[model samples]
Target: MKIRVEKPKRPAFLVPAVIIFLVIAAVFFAVHSFTETSVPLAYEITGFEGQVQIFDLSNHEWRDPRRGEEFKAGQKIRTGVDGILNLQVENSVRLRVKENSMLVNRECKLQKEVEIYRLGLDEGVIFGAMAKNLDRKIADNKAEFVVSTPQFDAKPFGALFRIQASEKADENRVGVLRGVVEVSRPGSLSGKGPMFNVRALEEAEVMEGRVQSPAKISAETWQELKEGYELLAKSAVMEAEQIDLAQKAGNFFEKAVFDHGTFFTPKVGYAGREFFKDPDSGEVYLETEYDVFPAGSFVGVYIKTRDFDISKYEGLIFDARRKGDEGFPDSFFIELKSKGSVLRKYSARGFLREWTPVDFKFNAQKPTLINEVVFVFTNERVGESKKGVLEFRNFTLTPKKDPVPVAPAIPVNVTDIVSPPEIQSTPVSEPSAAPSNQTSGQETFDEMVPQTISLG
Candidate 1:
């Protein structure tokens, strides 16, 4: 200090420069913290009915989805006229897609603490619900579920809601059953249009990109909402049963010989077939009835196929049973055909009133391609009319069996063989007689018939 040492002078811009640097750093971090990070969400087909088709982005092809099939973002699902689809999303949301509808998974992302799901409904209806309890492990205010239509977007918060988009009518309808939904134009998320709050028991409609005021939900719509919930509940149970059935099926077959969902056309005399669900088991089966017809009549149903190959299979197996106490024939026929010409014929006989597994084994010299499968019920009883119902399910092709091992030949000398002495027979008391009404034995035959005759 005593020496005339000048204090190092600080730059006049030093403080401002430091402050500006801190400001830029803070700004950059704030923006970074607010930016959303993409999250991959799982979409699963919990259950489905009828002709539900999915356009998968992975392969860019439309195909039928089986239960428990997982889908990712950008996949589209469409339903046929009688189709219904159930979806479980991220273990937090459940959706029921109604018939004749098209839906797409548009976006899935994580923004800060919020998990987001955006679905697009190009047309038709969808019923959705958020997990209400802690069982789903989703915290409150942690998820955002939105369904967007061409006319509007429906944003539901912890709610059960239905959205129906009618492209032909140029309108979109939103019905809220629980919690609240915000109905707005398609770009309302970006503050582009007006929004309306649809509360429980209320509904609203959008026309020409304008959301109408919330109104009381109609009785018809209420019924529909109730049914949707019921269907969702049933689907959960159905999904569990389906998984169990699949596990039990194991690796026995490669493909179903006939699916319950397929359409069967009547090919011959006075026959009708319909899909029926068992009340006790909740399983669906095909119930085919042959009306009272004269002897020698052929009653059957046939499903069209396209180059279905069974060259690698050993046989066809199915479960079938007679449905009534009277008038059913003791036998039926299964035919694999190529363009209506018979390729193989199998006669299944002596099926009981209970479900029985029938297997028909065949050895083909070459690869067999079938164009159709026909189930024929014939009235072969002379001078008598026959009427009966039959139940069938689980028709599948069985895998080929492994070859048997051969034993080595053994040499024997004639002197080594000797005659043995016979013993006297012993008398024993017979067992008590069985019930008169009950038969002690039953037989079933699955004989392969010559394929010389065609049923076309």
Candidate 2:
């Protein structure tokens, strides 16, 4: 019987099969653990400018919050006289607390398809920008916000809006740059409806629970406010070098130093739109696009400083580039126009798919103050030649001469604080660039002639 017994046959695949099964189980466990343990969404302090302080609810004391610091519900933040605090809530909404302002977080929820933020402004100004399509999502899913102040409570829905609260002035303001905001008194109706609806470019004031009629702001004022807040945000995030360059250029975009007032004769053009993209750096500086290939096609962003005299800046420096392949001309004219007399201009030959510098000096021969800056891309050639996108940016106004005294600082009233700061000529802002041995001056025709396109 012993001799007849055969050794038990081993299952050839048992060990390997068991090992594979264990590996699969381990992977599934890891994914399951990750899904089960969720980290709650929190408000992150993305950046700060000047002086900022935070009041912790648990600590019951104000402390300086670090960049990238996580703030939970019930924490409060304050910005001093020249301070700015930039925060991203639920990863969808950007909330900026301006100087002498305060913000307190209430609740934040990152739902399956949307995010919600509830907050309050005790006093001062708040700039809020919601990402595109996020406003529509609020109506589709649910109410996503509730912002409260002493005067009224609001639920803002849209891309850009602002709320300014002044306890001292007994004022509450709501301005919509892009979207709509539904507002009502504190502890008023729950679901029945909101009291007032403020639309894009519309503004309203609530004083002591009384909501005033909404009024549409002027296009110029709206543009100023938009630029003001954008500059604030940029300043909050900009590096040391970036701030230095921006300060030097007088911040044409942010400071609203210059504007494309009217085209002397524009065949084809677009304004305030993203029309140019850089080739190497890929940075879009200014929103100037022209596709005129005719005999005399010219367009420029004009500057109107009747409020002040800008006789100080004797020169201009900026970046310009033509868009397209080899068909378009690289020549353009940058004109510095003075209201009463002749205009000074520089003819430039430039490179397509790259940025070229247009640096010129304005003669003190004519009108005391420079009025407008215009770029004309004219092909005095035979006929309609080609199409291209002309872009401009990084403007540097040369050494400010003996500047006239700026008018007295405008009084900041309830309405005025909300208005954007207007740039006047007399009050020449000193560029914050470190004084180097190098200086900005007129780049003569002979200097850039070979590189410039032939217009004549």
Tens-digit lDDT track of model 2 for 1-456: 457868998899999999999999999999986673323567788889898999977769999889999877778899899999878764357888889988888766665545667788888888887743455567677537778887788787754678888875455788865557887777653755348888655788887678788886654445434632352232233333343343333344344342333343422322222322334564545534333333344543444433223344556677766533213444656555556343456576645467677666543432354555555555452123223345567766675667588888866678645666876767668879986863333343222211222322
- What's the TM-score of each model vs. the native? 0.43, 0.43
lDDT values, one for every candidate: 0.67, 0.60
Query: Could you tally the backbone clashes for each prediction?
Result: 0, 8
Off by over 4 Å in 2: 1-39, 111-114, 192-194, 218-224, 227-456
Measured with C-alpha atoms, the lDDT of residue 354 in candidate 1 is 87
User: 126, model 1: CA deviation in Å?
Assistant: 0.4
Q: How far is candidate 2 from the true structure (C-alpha RMSD, Å)?
A: 23.4
Q: How accurate is candidate 2 locally (lDDT)?
A: 0.60
